[model samples]
Target chain A: MAARLARAPGISLQHSIRHAAILLVAGRYRDTDRSALCRLHDQLPQPRATAWWGAAPLTDVHDPVTIAEGDDPVPQLRRLDRDLLRGARASEPDWLPDEPPNAWRGKGDHGQGGKGMMGGVPYGRPMAMMGEEMRDGLMLDAMTVTIGPFLRTLPPGLSLELTLQGDVIQQARVATPAYSASGIASEPLLRAARILELLGLPDLARRARISAARGDDDEGLVAAARRRGALLALPADLADVRARLDAALRRGAAPDPGEECLVDRLAGMEWQSALLRVASFDPATLSRIAPAAEPEEGEEEKAA
Target chain B: MTAADLAFYVLSAVAVVSGWRVFRTDSMVRASFLLMLSFIAVAAIMLMLAAPYIGMATVFMMAVEMMVMALFMVMFMMNPAGLNPMSMVHQNRLSIGAAATAFVGLTVAVLFTDLPHEKVARQAPVIRDLGHELLGPSMLVFESAGVTLLAAMVASVVLSARSGRFGPSDEGSRPPGLEPGGEPAGRVPESEQEDE
Candidate 1:
């Protein structure tokens, strides 16, 4: 359904959450994912609306346009966006309070300086401290930043805190496991379409998306897809899995075994490659192999 | 002042302010971008001064250089977004003294220097002569600089390769980073009997 939203008329899918006007929460998200959902909502610049389609209402959103199962959300979503843009509907206010994430103000009466050269809170953020450089122990600053859950690069609802050096991901650990997309997870063609999209073979990805939408025999589409070197374009390991899935989808065969845990596969890979690897897992395998969506008791509130 | 004079004044002012911001701003990414803005302002002044070739090169080269610098900033700099105000500075006394000394030196140099008189028509010819010098006896200097940069590039690659760029001792790592490339999990392209 999310796939079809991109192809829908009068609607362009926003790859960056920053650009999106209407936040669409489709399917069942983890109940405790409210903070993340709120964080994503707050990320959209002012004059934004959220559509909670077949998902539980987040606490931060006082009012949301809700869509029932079997109903098309795109129309409702478009209506909300249009209304907000036209000023007919007031843009939803931010759920999180307007304040710095932490008390970044400097300590002491003067508040001009700190231990050594760093005074307390320079412009409400601290100066970066040098750390062991990733390459050759040439001391460099090591920055840790969180990516996705709402980030367009990752599978929807998968967030990770990444330690990085320039373009290299030094360490990657899941902050929030991806929202279990159970409905599409089992469908081999749908999964293949997703991988194709990540592979930058969008035309073939589109064909796969179309076939997945139609939900019928895709033999002709598969034939055209193969001719386009859809399978050949992928790196060998992924290509092998994708070809197997594509053939299976064409002939209506059962899904092959999952390639396995995406975390290790994702780790050490750079941002783009990590995304590709995350998208490679067949949905069924991903759901099974991925860490459970529900967080350990205390970990829930600690996420933000 | 003439329009060119005014442009030079405004652009030079902006360049200096932004150059100051490159240090004053805490955000590494912002500082990198600020430096690009400063370079661009100076480049614009160069254009106004009739150094079109050098001006344009500065603009494009600085833009690319800043982007690469930003990438590295994100790569290595902790808290690249400045989410947390990390204002830790070391050797404040020395840094301030050095900055003051350099400022005084530059001012003195500018005051003492004898610059060429206004010769707009001759600017093109001057550039042409500079082009000649590149191919003339001064070629060794240019060649040496290129060799130096090439060596630096090789050195960085080798150093990073040993430490894995991500960290030390990560060998046989799969799905190598965006910058570094080695054998990334070889996926054998199996011929699947052309599924009938």
Candidate 2:
């Protein structure tokens, strides 16, 4: 369904909510994800509308545009976009309240807060504290952030609590396991296409997607990707990733699920590389490898 | 005032204001880019002062430098996007005093010093002259510096590589002992020692 949307000429799928005009809620979401969904809906820029594609609209959403299952959402999306621009349809109001998540509590007159520049939670969030880095043992500000469940880079429905210093992920903890992959979603062609998209080869990714949709075994797709230097684009040290990508393109059998935990493998890796490595695994394998922790109270876990 | 003189004043104001904003902005990324804008304004002033090569070079160099600086800021700084209004400045009294003194000293020097009045012809090959200056009299020095930079780049790449000539660079690789193999020198990680 996502591939069909991507193929549609008028409907451009955007990764960031800030760039998108319409919030397309697809697939089933857990009850716990309601707040996160509301947050995502609120994040879209003004003059926006929410369209539910084969998914139930949230109870709070007013006058929702719900597309029936097995129906193509492209035409409806186009109409929604056109109506938005023409002011024919009223824009959806923010689902979440327009207020800061945390209250301001600063010490000084100017709300300068904190002691000496490093010791305050100005807006309920603590400043990134200094911690020793893994590679060289340099003291750097390490930030803890919860990413995904909806972040386009990683597998859908997967969420991680990451401790980061610069671009490098110092530590990673799986907060939510990814959705179970349907047979179609786990197909090798689509899997290969996902990696190619991350590698910035959108043309090749499109070709792979088209091939999968057509149900035609295009042997030359892998060769063309190789010709475009896809393997070389990955870092040499990421040989495992390169091998997996090659195997994916050839529609090879799934690799043996490794003994090491996914979180352990992710640590000490740069964020982009770590995301790519995570994407290399099929969803079922990913869930098996990444032991999920119970979602902590107040942790923002977005709907996939 | 002539148009050029008017542009000079405007650019000078922009440069100074942006430079001031660099310290005032809460976001580290915004501060770096503000500094870049300040540099660009100064570069435009340089162009108006009839040094196109230097002006253009300054614009190019500062753009790249500030981009890198912004990347580092996003990586290292807390609250890089200025979501929460936070103060970027520090050392309030001392920094203010130092900045005021420097500004006064520079202003006094600018007002009193004998300044160069000579101007290069508009059609003169300033870039060519610069190229000649760098490659002729200072050829050896420039070439040596370039070579040194290249060497440093290569050495850093080699040192940072995870895979080495013998094996995985990070896997149980230890520095040799000062004497024989009494013990591997430096701080061996407790984890690696435990593995042994």
Candidate 3:
């Protein structure tokens, strides 16, 4: 899916949803993530189109065109783009309401302002709540945000709620585990291509993707990829991912990743490093390493 | 009003609103952004006052600084997203008094004091002149400050390193296979776990 979208001529894939004109949802999604997907759809600026390929559509998106198996969605997507760009097709209307989630228009009585210190909810999005820092017991504003399922950096269907402290992840929870990457995209070359894409080595990434799509083992190509320093540039924690890709290339076999504790691995890691660690593992491995079972009563507070 | 005057007023208004929003907004993330907005407006004012380099520098530096601030707020702040209305204040009355006092002092100084200035003969190469002044008699001071900044940067990197702080075990120990010492750093060896 990524290979097709990436190789698509003149239809650049935007990393950020804010810049996106269309939401190309591929594969299946967790029913629980319906609200999140809707929020993502609404987040795109006005006149956005959503195309669901081999996936069910939630009612949040209006007039979504579902692409059947073996159908070329590129033409439909191009037409949608052309229409939207030329003002021939009216831009898709917003599915979500325009108003704030809560009633926040009331004025503050005293200078104390709103609910707490900052004037409460001048808009719909509520302010972050306080939490103690994990590194030190010192209290700080802990920003909790749910990222992905759709985020570029994350594996699709993998949703995480992170409590962060200044680029440091104080805590991380896998709100939704990642699904196994579908189709031949999970081939070692495609996987390597995806990793290269994440590493900002786009030329090598495109080569790997295109080479993989051709459906043959090219030892020289893998050697060329390695020569490009894409594998070598990875941090130490990502060595396992590199090894897995290496093993898959050598022996066309899937390595079973043993159960690893997600929080233990992610906690105390900076955001970039955490992202690298997450991306290092194949989707299957990542899914197997479920976020640690919710702590028991005594351990719950400490976990939080 | 002339375009220049109009631009100045519009920029000033933007700066003031952003400045006010910085303290008023509950969200730590939003506050950081508002602060950036204020800085950008101030930078534009600097540009209008004929300091293009300083203005652009201010814009670049403040943008980076505010991004870092937002990251910090996201990490360390109690409520960066501001889901709940938060009071990011303490000693409110004292803060109000201090702010008011500073405002009065600044206003009085600006209104009542006589400022002396003479047009410089060669203002075109002001940056070059400033550079020369720094490298000439002030070179020692400049070098000393640079060294100090370098040391601080080194110190911060060392302190913030994941492996260095508190204890080595604070971070996960290396796998037995990865390490050269033929021993695990902290976690139980897989061989030992298998036996147990």
Candidate 4:
């Protein structure tokens, strides 16, 4: 097949057909009569087939490696993560659109018939001329009026009409709906939402606030909510929390003290670091350190 | 067998055995893996016989093709990594046996046939000559193979991929809405919402 492919090959359909037949026959025969024949039928390129496996009768090659021990010696997989990150950073071109048309195919010299040999210019400088035309077409007499840069900063729910000067920001007009702000409260619920999100307890925080504002003040519900909130406020670093709890206990301070405005101190503290320090001395450790356990039978065996 | 003969025989035995197993293995994936081992052993034999490129390409191309098959297996199979027995055996056991017998008979006949021997001393290195041959007419085959691979990729993507540069609906699906940054919409519509 290689000899045939090497000799008379200019995309040989017959050769491919024969190759396909060989592949079809390469598989083992389960119901060797019917399915094999059907495979033989499909293997032929033409419906009224001629090409077979030729004279090369397929035989089973016994692979000893399958039964052999481990994997064949090869290099371990190379890390391409850093290289990919580097490629991503280096691909940022200034001429390209800020948010390109699509991430897969970003805008800039996609198709111009000619390749990159001419430094992004097509042969005969047609693209340069077209760019000039686009610039000229952007500047018209009707668009020459002054509309301030602040016009683009439309408030939420307000609409805007933009006028461009050759892909540059030229003028914009803002139009807001009448009485859109009438029903809304002065304190933006959204600010609380942002705060809660930053606090990393958006759902529970919002629910608690909403329930309290609605005046459904069941004392049990409020107490439970506050308790949960305080617990949630406790830093995720177990060691730190444990250390703080132990220190408070040691100093005879209240274990469940009201500690508002402590978010700044706790923020960004590493979880494992705090956990390790706190876990270093639990109740058992403290007892061990102080020799507080009463003497018991089989204590010597237990210690051993 | 003597150690030298044993080494030669064992190498030849494994090479031939694995080569045979390449045909016998039930799973295509396993078959391909076996074929790689067989080829590696054959390449060892080639090192003995003094031909390198043929052995290397045999290993290289087979490895590449097997890797591609592995990828396709991952993408298409429902249990992508599950090891299930896939028997490719078909119905022609007797005919297959007959055909195998005939081919083996022919090969044995070739082996038995007498031929005149050339008594020239081995001066030219076999690997060098093999490399030259590969770079000769075989180079065109090499390049065309590359082109064929590219064409296959383009054709496969054209046939199988649902979406292209234009839109998804071109292949009979709803056109996916474009997000400015390709992220999902931050706000969920009331209709799509479910109870937490």
- Name the candidate that leads on lDDT: 2
Candidate 3 C-alpha lDDT tens digits along A193-292: 6566677877776766666656656667668757877668767876666676566444255566567677667887888667756765665566568542
- Judge candidate 3 at residue A77 and give its lDDT: 81
User: Local error of candidate 1 at A103, Å?
Assistant: 3.2
Order the candidate numbers by DockQ, best to worst.
2, 3, 1, 4
CA shift at A144, candidate 1, in angstroms?
5.0
Candidate 1 lDDT over residue span B78-132, tens digit each: 5566544456356999999999999999999999999888677733675777788
Ranking of all predicted structures according to lDDT, beginning with the best and ending with the worst: 2, 3, 1, 4
Model 2 over residues A114-147: C-alpha lDDT tens digits?
4344455565555777776787554678889988
Q: What is the C-alpha RMSD of each candidate to the true structure, in Å?
A: 10.3, 6.5, 10.8, 34.0
Q: Quote the positional error of residue B139 for candidate 1 in Å.
A: 5.9
Cα lDDT for residue A224, model 2? 93
Off by over 4 Å in 2: A7-9, A105-108, A111-116, A292-304, B14-42, B65-119, B129-196
Tens digits of lDDT, candidate 4, A92-199: 112222442223222234443223322332322212111111222211222222221111111112222334333332333332211122232311222222223333
lDDT tens digits by residue: candidate 2, B1-196: 9999899999999999999999888788889999999999999999887889899999999999999989878766766766456678889999999989999999999999999887778889988988898899989989999999999998987876755677556565576788897687765756678988
Q: For every candidate, give the share of true A-B contacts it also has.
A: 0.13, 0.13, 0.30, 0.00
Docking class of 4: incorrect
Residue B146 lDDT, candidate 1, scale 0-100: 99
Q: By DockQ, is 2 or 3 better?
A: 2
For residue A129, model 3's alpha carbon misses the true position, in angstroms, by 2.7
